[model samples]
Target: MNPSLRNALTRLAFMLVAAAAALPAAANIDIQHWVAPNGARVYFVESRVLPILDVQVDFDAGAARDPAGKSGVASMTQSLLDTGAGGLDEDTLAERFTDLGAQLGGVADNDRAGLSLRTLSSARERDGSLALLRTLLTQPEFPAAVLDREKARAISGLREADTKPDAIGSKRFARALYGDHPYGRTPTIESVTAISRDDLVAHYRTHYVASRAVVSIVGDVTREQAEAIAVQLTGDLPQGEPLAPIPAVTLPQASTENIAHPANQSHIFVGQPALQRGDLDFFPLQVGNYILGGGGFVSRLTKEVREKRGYAYSVYSYFNPQRQLGAFQIGLQTERSQAAAALKVVDETLAAFMAKGPTEDELRAAKRNLVDGFSLRLDSNRKLLDSLAVIGFYGLPLDWLKKFPERAEAVTAAQVKDAFQRRLSADNIVRVIVAGD
Candidate 1:
């Protein structure tokens, strides 16, 4: 399905690795929560460290929520939210933000869609930014012409991706793992082609409602101002109930899928359903994965597949914990001729690690790396704002950021082995290979 934690770890890995290689500070994140008048949940962090403000409005609408026959509706709705809203065209909205020195942007991922604003905390700039954001939220007009243009552009991009072996591998890997589930939904020429403006309007009406929203605020603002900002952002949206929960992920039975491609290198994906966000195994899996394949050049997989044997230049794995069970995935790009041998080594390496877990020294290094890098994740208010949005959307523990370090440190090697053995098995691992000789 969606490799949420994979994306998360890759981004965090960059920030975490570049931080000072010392012990992480004891984090003290004061997160506050409330409900706005319009039923939007609000998560606020009063930060006065800088004279700036960051606000994000998130809804439970994302790619996974797309209607059965319309895979791109949610993404299109989010992309068009600011194109023409409250009587302002896209260009006019851009100008308004520029004049206020505010950055207006958004993202639509597998589990959530959100818009964010960053601006100076001065009343003139902050108020203007919030006002503009409110307009985008409460009055998105999915202009038919704009929708048509974007659809054409998206089709072009999708078609281009269809030709690339790497793209095909990733998309098919999801299908191999989560067959018939919403998590595996990908934009096809047909699926995107079928999406009408009416589809966007309906998705916006149903999933962009106040009750499904999470208003996350960070940086220079009082609690009172934060509350008012949250209300202004969400108070006038359509009222709708929370969405029904997505179904649990069912792991694909073990099988190998080899597709012919002209590329000289094979793009391979090996994984299975493993863990969910906030699972008790989160720490063990997080720690153990670093020792297994997540620690960049120092990882076991990289050393075995790249450094030791020169079979590939890059190889890694991670646990992608989503709302339901996510995936533990190992990926590599190797020459077409070495595809079979590389895969054999990968299979043996995984089995050995699963059987024996990481050594004591490996476990210690994993904890140190994870703990030292934890602070980097919280180094900026923008990062913290993003974290708050994820927490609110997933209904995770409010103290998740605070507990990340200690929990990771507490994980024993046995715990890691137990967790991995219970969740992953050779019996269920799905393999996807593109471009084999």
Candidate 2:
């Protein structure tokens, strides 16, 4: 969630709304699919239970697509989409949505850029808000002044992040793990401030084209309406070429980067680029990650580092599968003096798990938690929209949701051990320690 939205939602968390429950078998919910005349792929799920609608438009334009010397173009383009569009300025756009009781936002990340709208299903509200959404999509102004303002804001944020040890360690970890891979590049103050309106226009024209779009709708609408919505969103898009696939990520050789900082606690990170989204090894790694470090109190790393030695308050690890090989990162912050001990314990815990695999009890518990909690993933329109966007964007199996729990259940201890052993070599791990002696 965006920080602004998070704060807004935090306040709304106390408000009581009519409670609704998803189907008992949320995983088995149907997803309708089609392609628009303009070459945009569309996915939809009709949930007439609520008189509401959620529509999202996604393109294969993310940070990884940023051109050399223009590291923040993708993000800036997404942000500026809502700044002004059609004939409306940011304030006018805000007023339009507010009048209609609609929520609007844009999301940009490593593999996708998206704009989303949530509105009441009545024709008066839905039709108008969606029309405004189309204008934002097809006619973003990228006003010169807004571009300058956003660039300055981004640079200011980056400058603050630069001073934080955790942020320093994370950025260094990416560079070390990816070397020259596109996944490694992030906006620096120099790069972000260097961006201009021309750069935003060029990137938007190239990357936000029709051929590269996925229009996802989850709401109380009919098939005819969904098709119309999809076309309205992408038909006017520039027919620029779809992005060429990102280059494959190569594993980094074992290395360590230790940076000195004036912080009381050291921030440490470990691991390397591990798996992409549709890999066969995903199941084993997902289940195995739980027992190894993703399960909180039950995880081996937490048990060894916090429960036994009290080196850190919390420790965790997980795989971030992306368009290319994302990372399998383990991260923790500890008192600078105890950083060494915490890191040693983390390594030992990982090594032991890789050698022996998770215990049967741990495997059962992990599977149970993942399976039992699967329904929550589809419990809301927003959550369903997320899944649809990912599926449409990544070209995953249409029945991926149905197969998710089955795959997790099928993963045994031996399979997990083998997957981890083959996919990760402790020898090739890259380590980053900030402010630790």
TM-score of each predicted structure versus truth: 0.93, 0.95
Q: lDDT tens string, model 1, 1-437?
A: 13753454455456445643432233768889988888899998887766678899998888999999889888999999989999999999998887777788887988889799998788987898999999999998989999999999999999999999999999999999999898888889899999998999888889988988999998889999999998899889888966789898877899999999999999999999888887888889999999999999888999999998999999999998888888789999999999999999999999999999999999999999999988888777778888888888888888888888889999999999998899899999999999987
lDDT of 1: 0.88
Taking the tens digit of each residue's C-alpha lDDT, what string does model 2 give over 132-196? 99999999999998888888888889999999998888889999999878889988998897898
- In TM-score terms, candidate 1 sits at 0.93
Q: Model 1 clash pairs?
A: none
**Best-matching candidate per TM-score:** 2
Error of 2 at 346 (Å): 0.7
Question: Which portions of model 1 show Cα errors greater than 4 Å?
Answer: 1-26
Top lDDT model: 1
